[model samples]
Target: MLLSAAARRRTPCPGGALLVVGDSPRVVVVGGGPGGYEAALVASQLGASVTVVERDGVGGSAVLTDVVPSKTLIATAEVMTLVDGSVELGVRFPGGAGAPTDPGLDRPGGAVTVDLGRVNERVRQLAAAQSGDVRERLRGEGVRVLSGTGRLAAPDRVVVDPADASADGPADGPADGSAGEELAADVVLVATGSYPRTLPDAEPDGERILTWKQLYRLQELPERLVVVGSGVTGAEFASAYDALGSDVVLVSSRDRVLPGEDVDAAEVIEDVFRRRGMTVLSRSRAQEVKRVGDGVVVALADGRTVEGSHCLLAVGSIPSTAGIGLEEAGVQLSESGHVEVDRVSRTSVRGVYAAGDCTGVLPLASVAAMQGRTAMRHALGDAVQPLKLRTVAANVFTAPEIATVGWSQAQIESGEAQGEVVKLPLVGNARAKMQGIHDGFVKLFCRTGSGTVIGGVVVAPRASELIFPVALAVEHRLTVDQVAQAYSVYPSLSGSLTEAARRLHKAPSVAG
Candidate 1:
């Protein structure tokens, strides 16, 4: 049966090409995060009128609160770590004529103190600038930007409530009207994103107890910091603060930190954390957190307590799907409250789609953007390939970062995948030797029959950047031999990746 133009817009396109529609469809995207904004852009490019309703600033948590702020803080910590290692490279900070000289680089008498106030100011400034940039870019793309809270009034309509006195007023509709405006959209994309999950007993006061968002408010550095939950966020902060000279403790309910990551990578990070004076409390869970006098205490489930100047809860995140009229609008949500989305980012309801952390998909910013683009392409009568998770690359941004792409070692061990594993230690790489880095490796997985690169893990400084080639290889189905034959800079960290692929190509195949 031939479908109407409107019906065709709601239908998913099979091929990866834009479907030229007779009429421009109206697209409404809620939330200004990477997922929301990217979807808006794609919809606009596909000849649809797009409006983005953003409650917070543009760029969402990944840019304004979570990813950008944390990574900036880590950059400062990395500088300190590099300075501490300068003595090994024959670099010397000479003492004053009458001052006593330090014997080792690690024990430099010149004490370095972090100016938390300055660091936080810079972080906020950077976040704000980036948010502004995103907003400007959206405007440049002819996407109508609405600064308000948007909720589904119906499958084809969105009601936007004006933001409070804090924001720059409503971006559309009457400025003085009490009743908000309602927009009729042919397609609605929900990308409201997620918020940091906190326990009822461990509420963040923003002073003593902090969420990742509130950490920037501190004027003074924490003398002792305790991080709850050993996930990516917790591990990153713990590692950064420790490097910044804080006495840090990381509490984990799992047997090890980053339990969901590559096992070898997680083990190496835990070892590095402990070796650098961090207290790793494995198999420990925080039952409650309370302010005691001038300090904070985290009571464990086993009747033990850990005290620190401040406590940070990194337990996890909850999708921001509540009170948004999603369920009432016939959008299916998972048991955990995340929007249930298919490969092409469609919701259960026609013309309604979801993306980002709100969909319970991979919580990375890159994944969020891809899902958003996919949702737009599918909803705006454009052809789109379904999202493929096998090629997604994720990184833990701790010092000497851990990055992994595609199939994991656990998959092979569980007989879920058939592959051969090959590893190359960074210590053997000339660049690593020159940089005095000894504790990292690159591991690659290849198919048994065709030597196709399936997955890989990289552990080293800037592993995030080093994993890109491997990610591309997996996404394009490039074979191990092809990767090995690719040219790489001599004496560079990437050589280790090529070397691992070369070894995988030469290794004998094992049956699944």
Candidate 2:
């Protein structure tokens, strides 16, 4: 049973720039994750009375178990790697009185060791803080935040059942059985993100067998961590754990790790992993993962077995769209069970839109936020530009992180796009020499004759930050000359980006 709209208490939106003549348009946003909460903010600004129904906390999985927590853990690993490598640059500890220290670039054997317990604690604290901050922000904007399971009664009506909880994120919030609240909405936005995919034979026990989300629960680091899957998630965990002084075994079904990423970037990361003594089992598919005593054993499809203290499954993720009452509302879903949405984040049904991982567009968080914002702009009758995937910047948070923007090399090779390419190794950069860095490169693409910046890839320490300029150029169709004209700090890794662009610069034609 749903409560009447007249009986519901509407949130008093604090500051709305857009003034409404009559009754403010009611917007019911389903999911409190990045897409859902972000849309709520936008809808509120547009003078729409917004109500967000979320099963988990305000920040969603990105803040709870996924992006925020994982990245915080990786930051510790990164500091260890940097300090361990800094020994070569004449930095010595108390024991080394006068002589140059041996940089353990091959493997980490320094006195510095990470406490997984402390690291996990910090990760959890940070995530909780972020979630709380988001909740307060939504409250400040007067967007009603309901912590309960939400379902569609119709395209424009949503019912929040406090008795039912959702499987979104890694939340275990207990539901209360109360008469649910009914929302009368002129528009509805669904931003329910995806959950980590699991195999029936290798179900996560959260002990020896775990998912990426459960990694933070571990007090002591695994003696030997076995990461199954060679994709972004698998590679990242493998890299981080290895740098954290754990013997890691990476199981991959493909020939090389990061099969979906850029080829050159994949090669650099794989080399780094192998050189650091991490065992990579390529073309090995795990058939089953089960506990045998204290440790876990993984049986491969090729009749081989690998044992480890813990196993982290990173196969992929499935969109959390089931049992949400989307189809009943005439919203068409894809064969993969993802909500089918257009450029403006519209579903097949009118007045109902979908975004984020649930739409199966792209798995990046930045992409999700853009999709959510675009959806609201269209819904509120504001001038809106459709979502442009090409302008979105993506990062792989590995050691010597890989970042990409716009066109990929494969698109050029396959004749799908016409562009000029230039590859510059970071070894030549002054910053690389000073920092004792020897691997990674910067690759840039541009229009053939016009020299317009089309795309770029950066591989280095914190490449995520370095790729933004390239993203800016690609989005605005800036020329190679324009990119080169922008000043980059000398003796810095970013200089390589402009240098790559400068290589593609063409001088003005003079009368012969």
Candidate 2 — worst ten consecutive residues by lDDT sum?
11-20
**On a 0 to 1 TM-score scale, where does candidate 2 land against the true structure?**
0.92
Whole-model lDDT, model 2: 0.85
RMSD of 1: 4.6
* Deviation of model 2 at 372, angstroms: 0.8
| C-alpha RMSD of candidate 2 | 4.3
**In candidate 1, where is summed lDDT lowest over 10 consecutive residues?**
168-177
Tens digits of per-residue lDDT for model 2 on 284-309? Answer: 99999999899999999999999999
Residue lDDT tens for model 1, 335-449: 9999998999888888888999999989989999999999888766566789999999999988789999999989998899999898888889999888878688999999988
Cα deviation at 189, candidate 2, in Å, is 0.5
